[model samples]
Target: MNKHNSSHIYGIRSILEAIIAEQPINKIFLQKGLKGELFMELESAIRKNGISVSYVPIEKLNRLTRNNHQGAVAQISPVKFHVFETLIESVLASEKNPLFLLLDQVSDVRNFGAIIRTAECCGVHGIIIPKNGAAPVTDDTVKTSAGAAFTVPMAKVDHLKDALFYLQSSGIQVVAATEKAEDDIYAVDFNQPSAVIMGSEDKGISPSILNMVDYRAKLPLMGNIGSLNVSVACGVFLYEAVRQRINQI
Candidate 1:
C-alpha cells in the first residue's frame, strides 16, 4: 500500500522486515499450502515474536492487495506502541504522581479513541491494552481521537493482568471502574500514583480483573440508565483524577 494508505504491507520479505523492525502489526495473512526457505524463516520469526497470523487461500491474499503479495499480507497499526515495562518505569521516574489507563478488551475503535483522548487530557502517563482482543489503532481510531492517539503513549501486552502486576510493583495503585463496587469514584484517593482500568463495552470489567484491582469504584448514576458508555465513564473516571490533582496544586 501507498504511504497515504499504508495500513497493510504485502509480500513475504517486506512483512518479515516489518516484523523484525517491531512495527505495530494487527495481523498477518499468509497463503495456505505454500512453503519455501524464506517462508520458513518468516514463520519462525512470527512464532518467536508471537505475532498473530492467519493461513488463507491464495485468492484471499489476492483480494487483500492488488500487488504481488507473494502469499503474504499484514495489517499494520497506525501508532507505534511502547514497551510496557519501559513505559511504566520512565513515567514513574519522571512524574511524581503517574496516572495510567488500562483497557480490558475494549473492542470498539471509536470508544478506544475517545478514551485515549480523555487520557491525554487527564495527563495520563500511558495507556495499556491487551494485544489480542483490544481494538487496533486504525485510521478511524486516530481520526476519532482527534490525533490524541499520536500524543499519548500506548503499550500492548500479552495479558492485562501482567501489566497490572507490573504497575502495582512500581507503586502505582490500580483502580477498576465498575458498578459492582460499593465505593464511588470520589472516594478513591487518586492523588497517589494511580492507574484506572475500564472494561469492554458489553460486559464491563471481567470478574478476574475486577478482583485484582487495588480499588473498585463506580460512578453515581441518577438516571434510569444503569451505566454510562465505556468512553463516557472513562472520561468521568479520568477527570476525577484530574480534578483531584488540580486541587492539590
Candidate 2:
C-alpha cells in the first residue's frame, strides 16, 4: 500500500480499512466506470456509513495522487469530529452557561478555520456544523485555524435543523446572525446558555433555519458594504458574547 499524505489515503483496500476503522473521513473520490468486487464492497461501506462521495474521472483521481491510487482516493479529516448529542450533553454537564457556535453551510475552508479560531478565543464550549454542506476539516483548514481546530470541539450532524432542535430542547437559546433581522446582536442575551449560528458567505441564513431560531440578530452596519464577511461577522458575534459574559462575571 502506498500512503501519499497524512491527509489522504489511496488504493481501495486502504480506504476500506480506514472506513472499517472508523477514521474521520471528509469525503471519498471514486473513479467513474471502474467496478470490481472490492470496489463494490467499498461503495457499500461508504453508503452504510452515509459518507460523502463523488465519482470522478480517472484524471481527477490522478490529480489527487500520483501514486497508484487504484481508482480510489479518500480525503481524511485532520481532526476527529465529536458526536453531536454526546458533545452537547457533556458541555451542558460541565459548563453552567455553555456557549456554542453553529455554521449554516459555511463552505469556505478558510472562513471555517477563522471561525474556529475565533470561537476558541471567545471561550466557546463547542461548534456544530452540518456534515455535507459545511467545509471539511482538511489540512488547509487546520493551518488556517492556527491550530485552534484541534483545540475547539466540533460536532457534525446529518442536518443542521435537527441539531438546532436538539440544542433548543437542551435549554440552549439559538440565535441566528443575519442582515434581515431587526434585532442587533446586542439585544440577544448571550450571557445565558447560547448557540450563535452564522450563515454562508454568499447566501445568509436559510429562511427555514431563521424561523426556527429563538432570536434572529444582525450586526449594525455603518459602512457602504451591507454585510460583513462570514468570519469577520462571526468574530464580532462571538466576542459580543464574550464581552457580555466577562462583564457579568
Candidate 3:
C-alpha cells in the first residue's frame, strides 16, 4: 500500500491536538520556515515525545491534505498502546508463562487483525509491533479482528530488535517462525515464557531480529504453495503452542 494514503491528519491545531492526545504520529511535515507560538509549542512537544518530524514545502503539505491544513500534517495510531514491561510483569505476577507475538513488519491490516484474533484465542499475553514498519491499527484492522483489538494488549517499540533484547533480558524466550529452520515448531517446549516473531508476507522476519532469537522453527508444509499468509502461519504456530501448554497440565 502507498505509505502516504494509509492514515494522516492535517491542520496545525489538529496535528497539535493529536500530539497532545499522545497519538502515534509516524511522521510530521510542516511548511518550510513557518513559525509561531503554536508551532513552537508543537515543536517542543514533538521533540520531547520523540515523534519524527520533517520540514517540507507548502506544496507538499498541501498535497498530503488539501483542506485547511494550516501548514502541518500527522499520521495517527488506530489502537491504544501499553508498556511492554507492564504486560510482562502482569503475566509473571499471575504465574502465567507469557505468550507474546511480535510482528516484524506486517503492514496488511487484515493480516494483522487476523493474527491478533488468533493470538487472543490462544491466550497470548500481548502483541508487539515496531513503531514504524507495522500496519497502523486502522478501523479495518479492528473490524477484521472482530473487536479483538480492544481485548488484546499491543506494545509499540521504537526498535523491534531492542525489544527482543529486552524480552530476552527479562527471561522471555524469543522464537522466530521462519522456513529457514530445520526443526519443526513442535520440537520446542512452548510452556515456557515465550514470544513468537512473524514477518510480513512479502518478506520474512528481518535478519537482525532473526539473529537475536533463541530458537528458529517452522511449520511442516507439504502443499504446493511455498508460503502461507502471515495470519494463517501465526494461527498454526500459536495453536501448536497452546496445544502443548494445555497438554502439559
Per-residue lDDT of 1-249 in model 2, one digit per residue for the tens? 536488899999999989988889999999999988999999999999888999999999999989999999999998999999999999999999999999998999999899999898999999998878889998788989999999999988988999999999999999999988898999998878999999999988889999999998999998898989999999999999999999999
Ranking by TM-score: 2, 1, 3
Q: lDDT per model, in order?
A: 0.90, 0.92, 0.84
Report the Cα lDDT for candidate 3. 0.84
Alpha carbon lDDT of residue 45, candidate 2? Answer: 98
Instruction: Please give me the total number of clashing residue pairs in predicted model 3.
Output: 1
Residue lDDT tens for model 3, 16-38: 77777777666678889998998
Better of 1 and 3 by lDDT: 1
The digit string of per-residue lDDT tens for model 1 on 161-240 reads: 88989888888899999999999999999989999999999998899888889999989999998989999999999999
Candidate 3, pairs of clashing residues: 11-69
Question: TM-score for all predictions?
Answer: 0.91, 0.97, 0.84
Candidate 2's clash total is 0
Question: Which regions of candidate 3 fall more than 4 Å away from where they truly are?
Answer: 1-9, 24-48, 52-66
Q: Candidate 2 has which clashing residue pairs, if any?
A: none
